[model samples]
Target: MTAPEPTTDGTYRDRIIAVEPGGNEFIADADRHGRPSQLVWTWASPNLEFATIFLGVLAVAYYGMNFWQAAAGILLGAGLGVLAHGVLSARGPRHGVPQMVLGRLPFGFKGNAVPSTLMSITAGVGWFATNSVSGAFALSTLFGIGPLPALVVVVLIQTSLAFFGHNLVQAFERFAFPVLAVIFALASVAILGKSDLGAPAFEDGVGGLGGFLLTVGTTFGYVAGWAPYAADFSRYLPKTVSPVRTGFFAATGLFLACTTLAIVGAASVTIATDATDNPTDAFTSSLPEWLASATLLAIAIGAIAANAINVYSGAMAFVTTGIKLPAHIARALATVFFGVAGFLIAWWALADAAASYEAFLLLIAYWIGPWLGVVFADQYLRRGHRVEGFLYDRSYTNWPGLASFLIGLVVSVLLFCNQERFVGFVVRAVPELGDITFFVGFVLAAGCYLVFCRAKIEAERVAL
Candidate 1:
């Protein structure tokens, strides 16, 4: 198939592929306002969210947390994120717009830059670094290679994968997802013997409403990036696919998987007697696989499947932020950068830095507050669930969204720092405040934006 050529700019976005009139209700043509256009679902469809959801939970569970806590973290963290996903993903197939473009209706064309760039930094350097680091750890543990050498290997692998982009990524997933399930299930059940104590408890003795809330918020917050891009894959899929079906399945799968992984991690702590930070080694040492040759292969494949998506998504964000390069070249740079960064960061944690991990996840979760809240408020209040056209139009600039997001972002940063007087008092008084930061951020964004949007509507009505 002939790949679509760029029109004037070097970016694939440099050109338009197709437009349907009358039938097209979405905003697409720069020449025409409010009419929708189909984006080249060039990267496979948003259905790839299956991988996104899976990996999001697996990350916290496998890397920083154990199986039991993975369970708690996923359930608590992802619940709100899942609720928000419904609104975000459903509109994609209807209008055929990418999340960032759709965002312009709410954030304004200029304001939209914040999210596009935020996604890039969070997913780009942050996510890339994380996946690359995991791969490095796997390689170092499985082989005799040092962490730095393993880090180099990780960077090379991610860069190579990014070079292939969509097709190879798709193939990698088909194989990786199934293998991961089998391995996770085996390990989970194997460790179940440790928790023969009884039915599950909300308290791992890490207990409290505060910790639970924080764990849940952080868990879902990590992948809150998906909310903006959920429909990025679904847009290519015919509207017939049923948004409700996709959303439910994906959300449920994510929630359950995280719960399972957390349970397994906590269980492993007791069974394998592993105080080790990385949970992968616990599985290998306990299972027959460690002594066998397949350990390296399993770790490598899992890392590749996930790191591929991380790099791919990061590349998309980088391109969106104006890299002025072909998709392949852009993706290559992100993959390598993250790969090397992740490897090196791994060295920073030699012991169980549980306090540090909590602090980091909480800090990261702060971004989710403004982004998700603004998105939610944008779709529900300002637009009335109606897809806005001329999304790039200055008139379409929903100041409510802009103000709300900025205000929310600033508040979240302050609260996260704990030096701010009122916020500090709140966090100090309420042990559970850390767990619910997403709620604070989301509520602030939504409440503020909704009030402003309502006032704007009233002003327009009076003018008429």
Candidate 2:
């Protein structure tokens, strides 16, 4: 459990333009620099884009929630996710490793591969593609340069930032914070001014408890999706950093940005309800030409900010999968691989962005909910224990944790999934129950892990 020796001279400490060395290795003490306050921007800047806003749009436009209903659901769901994010972020400085590496404590080295690979794919290709499409659409809307060309431009900038790695990613997010925040704030005001706050839910939408829960799940998916990457940013901070302040700032920034923008999306859709085909264009159509243009630029910049983290953390997660590669270049190579894969996926997704995105958001919550369950349960059981050595112990295995996770995932999805492609029997039988798969999965996984992992964790604690 002893910390890794401080290697190198910390040359990349403040060097934003430099390619960050190492791939999911323990961060040396020399490299541990940055304040907890910086997390505010690190978290905030990414959510200041159209993707966050679109979550709200889906609540009302797709999920039959009234503005107030959507707002309440957004608050409940996003608040839960943000709380989890703060706790995870607080673990970073103490661990000095990527979140997926820390995940070894729960799922063990080999078993951890399940969630690690899932995170790699979800964050890398899934989110990368989602944001890339949004950014490209914004560019096309702003400049009439067409989607393909705009996609190329967006992908290159984000991929470059991610390729250079963490320092550049953090710096870019910090730099982008003010610009994206200001424009989105203005757009929110304008959109709200035009919105009908008292408007009733859409008749054709998924009304009642089903609609409300769907809204909650969608918003939860959007915000909580960032939880796995929480430590990836904070792992570089000095160990002396206050966990409370770190969690507070990270949670505050995420809550403020995500809630405000999503509310704006819900409000905007009250006026532009028929925007299913092109939600991005519909979102900005209500604003003045100048403001709209500025908003489009912000969305594009925000996409880069968001995807940089996606690709960076995705690479980090990919490396944690026990893949053999030159340590120095493993993460960088993974970054490139994800970037290319994401670009191709994004191109295909642009054809049906709205429908595709709704499914993607919900899909994120499906696995994440159960994964969070197992990890949090494991973390709780191992409290006050130093298990850092287990991270590098390739032979360590936790099949019970793995079993619980899969059980929760499969059972919940089978009974409660409610997507366009598939609806679970629970919803099919009782339509008002809504899609509570995330809630069910989380409880099932956490309960199962707690029961199954108790003896193992006790043995581990005694051994330590």
List candidate 1 stretches off by more than 4 Å. Answer: 1-73, 196-207, 223-225, 272-279, 290-299, 322-357, 382-388, 392-396, 416-423, 455-464
- Which lDDT tens digits does candidate 1 get at residues 20-48? 11111132333221111211111222222
Summarize candidate 2's per-residue lDDT along 191-216 as a digit string, tens digits: 99999999999899988999999999
Consecutive 10-residue window with the lowest summed lDDT within model 1: 33-42
Of the candidates shown, which would achieve the greatest TM-score relative to the real structure? Answer: 2
TM-score of each: 0.73, 0.97
- Local accuracy by lDDT, each model: 0.52, 0.90
Candidate 2: stretches off by over 4 Å: 1-9, 272-276
Model 1, residue 302: distance off in Å is 2.9
State each candidate's clash count.
28, 0
Return the top candidate by lDDT.
Answer: 2
